[model samples]
Target: MVVDDSPFSRTLLADSLQQEGCEVVGEADSIECLIETYRQCKPDIVTMDIAMPGADGFECSRALLAHDPKAKIILVSSMKDEETEAEARRCGVVGYLQKPVEGEVLKKVIEGVMSPDVLYNNLQSWSIDIFKEALGQSITRMTKTTATFVEAECSEKNISQGITVVIGIIGHYPGSMILDISKESAEKMAEVILRRPAKGQDEVVAMGAEFANVVGGIACSMLNKKDKAFSLRVSPPSVFYGAQTEIASPGIRLHCLYADSDFGRIYLGVGFKKGSVLWM
Candidate 1:
């Protein structure tokens, strides 16, 4: 909930909080209806302004605290007086912010007050980052060559022919990591990792699958370690070859990226049915 005498300021504050993933339950311009509104909404946190019609923020905060001692309130105002801030603290305001607040700062303050939602958001945002870091390191270590990673459009049309390695993920959310590369690229990777010429198509399949496995395993391990809620496990890689093989999953969202290696380009996609759909 947000309480400010100015409707414009209140709306601006509410919009900023919403952008940071905070759900504003209610808004108020006066203290007359604040108590009843608070009781009705039971919001997680309340942001209060110093200048209101009837009573100032401090008085309203004190009154609310008197009613419910556990009420979480944050004083947000242009007024910056040490004595006033001290009085707010004395009344039970958990945080104090000046007139303008940055998005990240607002998020941090809210995170200090309530952490579960922020933690979940952090996990979902980090999902794409896991794969981003994993693939760069996996190829660099295995092939002893640096790769250029860049954001790419993610869609079913991007799925191409040649060597494709599919690795299923189970835990946290059921999804899969798909790796696509040309046969020549697979052979080059296999030969480089093997330190010799890849014998045949069998060697290409084995090496391609192993490469995908390394990426999926490292990425999932990072994700699982991020939080207890994400107990992600990477499945064995399934190798497919040629354009005749078709892959389809109707109800999953995909995030795609490509890395350019010394030998060839490698495309990686992570698909899941749930969690943060838009990657930041």
Candidate 2:
């Protein structure tokens, strides 16, 4: 299956897969449709886009993984982020690929994962020590939420004003991290883009998205290079303003609390859905 919001991307992926002598079973432009298709067709592998219309690839991957822990989902996107890659592993994905993907590369990765030896080798390649190092630069545990989640309860305090970013990272070597904070958090992050404070909701989302972008980018690099590459793909960050409901999945949600003078509540949840061991 292929899940992407861009019509051009979907067509290109389908054509490439067919050229590789692989069958293109189905395609979806949004998360809801992708889930429905997954239920109907249990394809051996899935190549999903990082960004989508409604749910996005990250949310879609989690939903699919929740239903089938061993689901062979590959994240294919232009947006590369460390947090996204880390989340993909936590989500139990079988593979991850970057955008402008070549058909040969996709074919090789798909065939490689099917082999028990290759899978073992890939797993051996992922290292946690290196991940800490790569992300260690701006890595700080959050006690409060960073303007990502609508409403987040943290060790330091509760977020009430501004926007909240709620993100879930799922995979082996796994976990989920939510950055909850206020509008102030978004404003500070905007400097990276506009060279100044963000002035509106659009600016805030862009900044917040960039924050996710950085986290996901670093995570992807670590996952690909640490020891060797394993199947991992990070989804684009989803940002929402105001208070929202609790988002849940089947994996062991690990929350990391980082709070200080900068961003507010940053909660990260670490969850594991051991391969071949999940009931759902």
Candidate 3:
């Protein structure tokens, strides 16, 4: 929501937010209209103009905040002085933006005011995207056939396969990816890639490790590019073999996904634990 007396400023702010893919839920010209509009729309962020007709931005902010203590409000004005900014801070304003604020600047301030859980959820989404796309594209590049997620086990997320490769993710978000593909399937994929018969279980194990390495490296590279804070690095692949093998990761967010291709189904168990000492 935007509360500004000037139609041009309101339109500009709304347009900038819309370009950022945010919906403009409500707009108010002054404090008189802000409360009703807020109650009706219940927007996530309210950008309040400091200079208005009657009450000014400070009183308006206080009024709205009194109504909703949890309201995330941003004060915008031509006043860039420290005193004005301090006053805004004292008024419970979560963010302050000077007039002629750039669209990206406004977006960053809005993101800054967002709750930690919301921000973490966004990071989780981006991380999951990197993992899913890396696995699918890597397999497709290797086998020349499209791979996609199929029906996957939700309970236990177990791997009832002959071989499992563990890849460690280190740095900001430490995690592990357990990749499992049966020995026969691994051999078939090796045959497809090498255009020859796979040597045996030895070669299959090596190939499986290499496959996990490639996928893990891709995920880490993408994350490192996403944000330097992620500071992610892929650890050397570890290989294990058994029937009904599973690994436990305490204090981590976990998700299991399975993808299928002409070769076979790939069972992936991915988990990440936060609170690592950031590398940079």
Best by lDDT: 1
lDDT of 3 by residue, 1-280 (tens): 9999999999999999999878899999988889999999999999988889899999999999999998888887787686876687678877767788777667755754664445345557777668878899889888888887854544544546778888988854578887889888899999988889887878878988998899988987887676544557889998888556765545665677888878888887676775412221
Q: Write the per-residue lDDT of candidate 2 for residues 180-238, one digit (tens) a residue.
A: 45676566655544666667779777666556545655655676554232434455577
Measured on C-alpha atoms, candidate 1 has an lDDT of: 0.79
Q: Candidate 2, which segments miss by more than 4 Å at Cα?
A: 116-280
TM-score quality measure for candidate 2: 0.44
| Candidate 1 error regions (>4 Å) | 1-121, 245-247, 275-280
Error of 1 at 71 (Å): 25
Model 3 weakest 10-residue run by lDDT: 271-280
The lDDT values for all models are 0.79, 0.59, 0.79
Q: Candidate 1 residues 1-280, lDDT tens each?
A: 9999998998899999999988999988888888999999999888889887789998899988888888888888888687876787677777777777776666666665555356445555787789989999999899899999888887566546588899998753578888888899988889899999999989888998988999999998998677534557888888888666555556777778888888888988887655321111
By lDDT: ranked, best first: 1, 3, 2
Hey, what RMSD does candidate 1 come out at? 14.2
RMSD of each: 14.2, 13.8, 10.8
95 Cα displacement, candidate 2 (Å): 1.4
